[model samples]
Target: MKKFQPQPGFVVQAYKFALDPNAGQGAALRSHCGAARTAYNWAVGWVTASWWQRRAEETYGIGADELTQWRPWSLPALRKAFNEAKHTDPRFAGWWAENSKEAYSTGLANAAAAFDNYAKSKNGRRKGRRMGMPRFKSKRKARLACRFTTGVIRIEAAARHVTLPRLGIIRIHEPARGLLDRVQAQAARILSATVRHERGRWFVSFQTEVKREIRRVTRPDTAVGIDLGVKTLAVMADSTGEIREVPNPRHLDSALKLLRLASRTVSRRQGPDRRTGQKASKRWEKANAHRNRVHHRVANLRADALHKLTTAVAAEYGTVVIEDLNVAGMLRNRCLARQIADAGFGEIRRQLTYKTRQNGCRIVTADRWFPSSKTCSGCGAVKAKLPLHVRTYECDACGLVLDRDDNAARNLAALAAAAATGTGVAGDQGTLKRVSKPRGADQKTRATRPRRKAGTGRAGGAILPHQRQTETRDRTQAEALTLW
Candidate 1:
């Protein structure tokens, strides 16, 4: 029998470490990160400028290969370009060597990737119609990420030391816990290493290719459906009737006052004037750093919450079902945008999608257009109109009234179950929910509204008993939408 060759798997993870780098060490890392950024920006400018003057003549048009010869796309070519430009251009004079080479490499890598993507799109091989050039990254958003190959990154067994190219030897925050053992066993190979600085701390990340023993199935029969929203990070319903709630972190909201104060301070300071060749005042710079630190803390907190939630769900469920949420589109709604961002709704789904793979769980993505909220969980009675204001779902034909979101969650759970059974319905089934508004509780339906005989709506939503409903009447008193 042929040996079982497990499918290729990857683990791209970042870990926090308590790195107390000396002043010199910290400066060196910063320089390298800056160099990478410079390199990336330089390459983007060069390629774009070069392409600007040229014309597309051939049937195949100008691709990365042809343009690479006429331009600098490879690392060596990019380095050479930066070397010449560093001195001759005057614009970048005395800027090279002082900063890390990684910074320069970043720019080149970005431009190269962009060009390559365009080339793929031009050939009609890429998905979603076509692609665009990778936009250049801004300095304000630049993060320290250094890529080092095998010879550039090495581990010393006896001393537990790391020897980076040019940077020389350094100590790891923690011992390479059994890393060498795995390497010796031929289970892992170091592909690349990156050192980053964030939250006033430094960390080294290794991108390795590892061969692992087959992961056995633990709970193949278990499946789950996860519904993500702003009020709660997620309302997960599983085959076992368990509904897990991961509350929103709202990190930004907590730091809002601090952020506002920082912004006010920054505004009052003498900011930099680019045209006048002036750098920001020391005070301004300090204020900026303070603001950034707060932002970083919020991010860290949010990430922690999400990872915990997703990890739990992935480990507990065998087959996970999640709606293909359009987070970007949803963000357009200003009222919910901040809440959604704080909730990290998109991030939760993303984490769940990937973690399930590691936990012997299959992720079933419900279609984006699928109406998991409108349809009745008990019977397939889809409502024609569901408003955002309505907290409860009441099926007229079936006479089922339940919490709107809960009802939706139940429908999603049922849909996931149906799909797993290999017998499922696709597309919208006239599924609609009551138009819910965020307001006072006890939103009993208006008396004027004719109540259809019972047995339509099933499952519950986020209604906490005393939910409100809009009051619409035809008389001269007007449509008073007073909550109950």
Candidate 2:
């Protein structure tokens, strides 16, 4: 398949709107998503059947050349096989034609990607954590979603409706005048549309290639460093010696009482029991929905706050510096995990990344191990350690006292200055510095004891190809830094 390349001066973006479908349309949406799931499951089963058959044949002393042929998992292969069997296959024979083919294609695409990832991970070609074989998705657990890459996909002239492939026109909760105007003016072209059921509501997201006008920052000569934390959401210190703080909203903490009440109500109701094949009562469903509403609202509030904060910072500063925080490791601390997660440290950096690009500004990411808080902003003196309990930073060498967050923010701002001037400042090298790997880091821990080799299984007590272990690389190795 050819990769999509947007025209020069244009970028791909998604515009999402809340959908308000009628009851019949809602059922049709569910049916489409279910069709996708069905297709995905069929693909998995067909491909794995050969593996099971080969294993059985080995037990019977059959040669490898005589084993059952393996089924192809590529999209075209799966589509062709599905087309041939749909009329006779008991699982999908009766109602497979009700939903659009794109729904099934979406599922097949997902399954193929899952298999590809697993293969890459197994062969040591993929990064991050190792992936296991793809498993069947449970109907109750799978998210309801479908994508339309072809056929009619458009935002209506009315600005309050959208037309999707096969789904037809559906009303939306909010006006899409911005996207509609862009399309009418030939400034944007819709590439695809995805409908998803999430957080007790339906949403349609249109992927489009948009021609964006580049804009200058509010303060073109200024650089700001943002120090994110649980107590205060952000402490921003600019190169001009001005400091600002944004307080953490703690949305989840504020709504905990209501959430607890909702949870208790759900617990008292007759919920579904998969083991006993029992369905949930109407009251249980209602209570569960109420609990979900609270969670959804909290998520929405967090997203809105982060977007506003990131946009303001991106628009104001020519250069934004933020730390590469170890959020995954921080979550292991049970006492502060909830608070840290609620702060959205990772999300802030992610939003700033693209926002800065769009605003014609740049972003600098400090090394994760950089001692921003331990290094004194004044006199460039480094402290051995700084405990979390000490909110005030008192530099022993320079007699400079300042708020810990403010001091950290100042140090971060110095990094941007160092990069700009091609000189070290406040102990920060112009380029990112490498540090030794610390114990109890976010990555997989090294084994203390000697590890055993893969053991033989059913066939002649020999280790299978899939069972061989792959070597892991050191992720803390030094690398060149580039501005974003």
Against the true structure, whose TM-score is highest?
2
Candidate 2 accuracy as lDDT: 0.84
| Candidate 1 lDDT trough over 10 residues, lowest sum | 475-484
What is residue 200's positional error in candidate 1, in angstroms?
A: 4.3
Tell me the alpha-carbon RMSD of every candidate. 17.8, 8.8
Estimate every model's Cα lDDT from 0 to 1: 0.65, 0.84
lDDT of 1 by residue, 366-454 (tens): 77777778888667788888888877888877788876767667767776667655565433421222333633455665764567533
Question: How far in Å is the alpha carbon of 477 misplaced in model 2?
Answer: 29
Question: Over the stretch 339-366, how does candidate 2's per-residue lDDT look in tens digits?
Answer: 9999899999999998998998878888
Per-candidate TM-scores read 0.73, 0.86
Candidate 1 at residue 77, lDDT? 63
Highest lDDT model number: 2
lDDT of 1 at 375: 85
Model 1 TM-score on a 0 to 1 scale: 0.73
